[model samples]
Target chain A: MVHLVIDGKGFQAEEGQNVLEVALENGIEIPHLCYHEQLSPYGGCRLCLVEITRGARTFLSTSCTYPCLEGLVVRTDTPDVLRARRLVLELLMPLAPEAPRLQALARQMGVTETRFASDEEVDDCIRCGLCIRACAELVGAEAITFSGRGERRKVEPPFGEEALNCIGCGACVFLCPTGCLHMEDQDGVRTLDKWKRTLSLKACASCGRRYLPFAQIEFARQKGEDPPAEGWFEFCPDCR
Target chain B: MGKQAIERIVEKYGSDHADVLEMLIDIQEKEHYLSRETLQYLSERLAVPLTRLYHMATFYEALSLKRRGRHQIHVCMGTACHVRGAARILEQLERCLSIKSGEVTPDLQFGLATVNCVGTCALGPVVSVDGEYHGHMSASKVERMLKRYSETEANGVAVCQK
Candidate 1:
């Protein structure tokens, strides 16, 4: 454990624990978008900017990526920190104006309007990369990716081709921060619109109702070496 | 032969994950571009995910996924080249090939693309074809330069037929 000072409050955090996690744990409440407990630190949002002081040198960094250390001093709401956070929010407003979380964060930060122009074609996506990270980290399926940069940026399959090795698990859809990705089931076919691919749903043997994509169950089976009995995965939880 | 060559590359690189980028560059050097099958093979041989290979393919400017044409045409769109009427030279090439930038001809004879800068700013209006730099390029010289390479190199196995 290491002792650190955040906003004049002293607290003990575990070794290598990031400042954002430490602050949130102690109720410091540093606003952030790209930081997720399950996924790795991306530091893409830039909203968790904080002023850190060590000995005599002082600098600003996104707290989510900055680890806590012994005798470290941090401030979450300094003038420079607020200035940088507000500008980042303002810049992001055009990208996801309709996202409720982003809008609420902007309002909380007193950012009512944006100085930059918005492109109507981008829809409501903040590009925090939660979906991509979740798919790659949790489900172990990288069905979609963030390609290009700036005006040419997009979240899609590489080379504009159909998703390769996608199991249609809907992990990306479930974890999307801005609700940009969509998944729907119809006539035993699972359609992940954002990924532009379709999957067949497995019907419960007893209930005759579709429960999950066949690929998801196949993916589960592939993870384990021992093969289960026949019809082992053919039933929903309720039927089982 | 192709699969063997890629396997040899992995063996040469010792399948180091950090050396994936270097391995990809070498494969691109041999295949001219990274094909899906080749990348998949590398992913398995290196014990890395295909997603990572695709990410690297997109991240680096040197690598390409599509099969490149026999003749490569890169027009420098840098500040120095732009000032020397590089746009006119690009326009001339596009007209000659009847294809837009970043596109290859149907016969796989030539590909037209642009670059930010080649660091040879002194050679303004520079255009490179198959790694041969042509400095001081002019719109009128586009046809003469293209005439140096004849057609019928590739069958365009994946050609579009109406």
Candidate 2:
């Protein structure tokens, strides 16, 4: 186990674990978006900053990507860290005012309003890149990505066209923290309105309820054979 | 010419994920802008997804997804340059070219853009035309700079300029 000091408290972390994971595991909250446990860390959102000191050097680093090193000192609530986090929040506020998750985080940080002006109003995709990372890493489809640049930057399918490779696994919907992604399940159809795409769902053989996408089932089928006792293609989890 | 050259570049980069940025730069240098075909070819050769390539292309200002002109003009808008009337220089260029920033002229002779900084604060209010730096730019000097690019069309009507 690797040992480190966070907020003046000694903590032990398993090797290869990031500071954010260890901190959250130890009951310390460092507010962050664009970070999912299953997806690779993409430090696009600079909100999870912590002042890390080692030997004689000290600097602010995003806690999500910063690995736990022996004898490292991390301070999450320092003045500089708070100031930087507030600035990030201020910048992100105008782009996604409708996001409940972001609003809750702003309240926790005591950020009342944003000083900057934003001409563009984004629904919930704050360009934190969580969905992009999830689609690329977790789902392996890489369906969605960031498009445009600077103030016009946004997440969308490649070139603002439909994503041909998206399998409609809903991993992006599942991992999105801001609730920007919307999905609808009707009859046996799953519609991702953002991507303007839809896929067919597999109805449970026993319960006749739509449980998962047919493409996802095929993906699982390719992974390995189903158990002989409970056939994979026949029924959903609840029905089985 | 573009596809064959891009194939050579992919072969040169050798599928190393870390060299994606470098490969993109090289391809952009050769092709002027990243075309759809080039992006798709690079995606397949480098094993990077097309969406990912698009992401990278859009993220960096140096890369352009759309077709650009033969000549590119970059106006510095860093703190030092901004305070030194770079905005007027950019505005003048826009007026003379009849195009906004991130646009190309109808003739496709020039493309206009702004960069945050060029790391040369000493050369405040600098404008780089096709990689040739012009320092201490003013609204009046913009005419001369553009005239250097178009001699035959020097008398072309500017859409709007104060």
Candidate 3:
């Protein structure tokens, strides 16, 4: 464990854990995007900027990628950090204007308007890359990816084509921060429109409730997952 | 990509995941762009996730996911160049080529792009074509420069005087 002071409050963090994880674990709020615990720390959003001090030297660093070190003094609520976070929020404001989470965060950060101009309407996909990371890290599908750069950057299947490697896990849907990845279940079919794939959901034998997507179950089975002794893919989580 | 090509890359890099970027660089240099097939091949051979590879590919300006042309034009848009009308030169190139900053010509002859800097601020508004630099570019010079490329392509001679 490494002892560090965040916002004048001393906390002990596990070795190799980042400052954002440490601060959030200790009930200290450091606003962030794209800092999922299951995925590797990608400091793309730059919202978790915090001031760190060690032996009279202080500088701003992204808390998500900055590892906790001994005798480090961290300040998440510094004016400079807040200012930087607000700037990032403003820069990202036009991209996901309709995202309620972004709106709430903007309100919390006291950012009313963005100085940047938007020539066209943009979707709620903030491009924080959570879904891409989740698909790669947790699900191991590596289905989605970001293509292009700068203003043309977007998350999509490779070359904007359909991804045959996708297993219909819905991990990306579950991990999306802005709720951009829409998953709809209708008539025993779950559709992930952006991925251009659909899957038939499995019904729970006990209650007839639609349970896991069949493709995800097949993926798990292919991974040599042990079936429950009571049944084989028949019961939902609740019924099981 | 063939399995043997991927195997060659893996063998050359000692199959270390840290060398994925270098391996990708080599592959892109040979293939011109990172095709999906190549990425998938590298993913299986290198044991690195495809999405991570894609992340790295998009993170670097040198790596391109789409097909490029035989000739690449990199326009410097650094502060010094920008003040000296780099945007105008880029706009002129886009108009002449009928392609955007990051797009390739339909004929696969030319690819236009902009860079932050090339550490040559002395030559503001600089453009590099096929690794050859042209300093102090103006919008009027774009047509003549492109014509030279077309002439070189047709005549089979390296006659780009600039």
Candidate 4:
């Protein structure tokens, strides 16, 4: 345990937790993104910046990445802290105008509208590095990596081809807070709600409900080929 | 295989929740589905509310409440699979089976469903027939696979034997 003074009130917190985590655990609200508990903190958004005073020196730092120390003095809701956070939100608005969470956060911070002109074109990723860190740190599959430099940077597999090593674990999909990365099945059937989709056999020409892979059938037809009869069976949905 | 053996096994375990799921899975594997008698026995032995047990069974993607066919065909729909014409394969299977994704035939020979990514993206379009992986597939290939399974059914043998 470590003793710390946050906004003139003394409190005890665990030794290793960062300032933002400790505050949140203690019910003190602080604005932040790109700081999910499941993933490593990138501190890229800079939204949870706070003013800290120890002895005579006072400095502004991101609360998400900073570790809690003994005898530390923290002030999260100061005027300078609010001003810096508001500016960070202002900068992010032009980049992602359509994001509802961002818009709501901006409104809460007392910003009526964005000061800068909206950049009409933008990709879904905010370049927060959550996916990259997860792949490297959690899943142990370095199949995906950030490519290019500066504004042209984006995540891609080797040689820009399909990721062969990807296990389809869907960890990256779940961890993405912005809902950018999307996944579907091999047959091109997509189900956002995992349990809703049903599995039934494709109908055979001969039998009414025999089991068959519909996507594979379509593929063979398009290529002007006939399916084999030995391994495959055709039936109707009911018969399958 | 006998009733006495099943009763002895059930008595030894006393039906913990996890054990209940495992037992249900084993029973389904042997009997093709959970029969009304089996469900009743499980409900009593496990001390689990019948309604709660039903809810859990239906909640998971892996479990099924209805009787299944002799063969199960699982199609992958992960992002990698979708981009490579997996949809076409599904359509072909639907046409061949004469049944939709979730329905079983009147004869109870096959069951089909679409699954989320199975972690084999290199084989963009992949299908699993009774847990066997078939990669780099097409619609025609799927039909051929089904034909083979039908032959096994005619022979009174399982198609997924390793």
RMSD per model, one decimal: 4.5, 4.0, 4.2, 22.8
Which of the CAPRI classes, incorrect, acceptable, medium or high, describes model 4?
Answer: incorrect
lDDT per residue for candidate 1 within A39-142, as digits (tens), equals: 88888878989999988989999998999999999998999999999999998888887888888898899988889889857677777888788888877787
Model 3, span B1-162: residue lDDT tens: 577887798789899989999988887776678888888788877778776788778778778788876788999999999999999999988888878998997767788988889989999889999778989899989877877777355532322331
lDDT of 1 at B12: 91
Judged by DockQ cut-offs, the docking class of candidate 3 is: acceptable
Q: For residue B131, what is the lDDT in candidate 1?
A: 82
Q: Rank the candidates by TM-score, best first.
A: 1, 2, 3, 4
| Candidate 3 TM-score to native | 0.80
lDDT of 4 by residue, B51-89 (tens): 434544554455666777678887888899998888888
- Among the numbered candidates, top TM-score falls to 1
Residues B1-162 of candidate 2 have per-residue lDDT tens digits of 367787787678786867888888887877678888888877887788899889889988778888776779999999999999999999998988889999998877788999889888898889998888998888888877877776366333342342
Q: How high is the CA lDDT of each candidate model?
A: 0.83, 0.84, 0.83, 0.68
Quote the lDDT for A40 in model 3: 98
* Model 1 alpha-carbon drift over 4 Å, by segment: A158-161, A204-208, A225-240, B96-98, B129-134, B140-162
lDDT for model 4, on a 0 to 1 scale?
0.68
Would you list the clashing residue pairs of candidate 1? none
Model 4 chain A worst lDDT window (10 residues):
A191-200
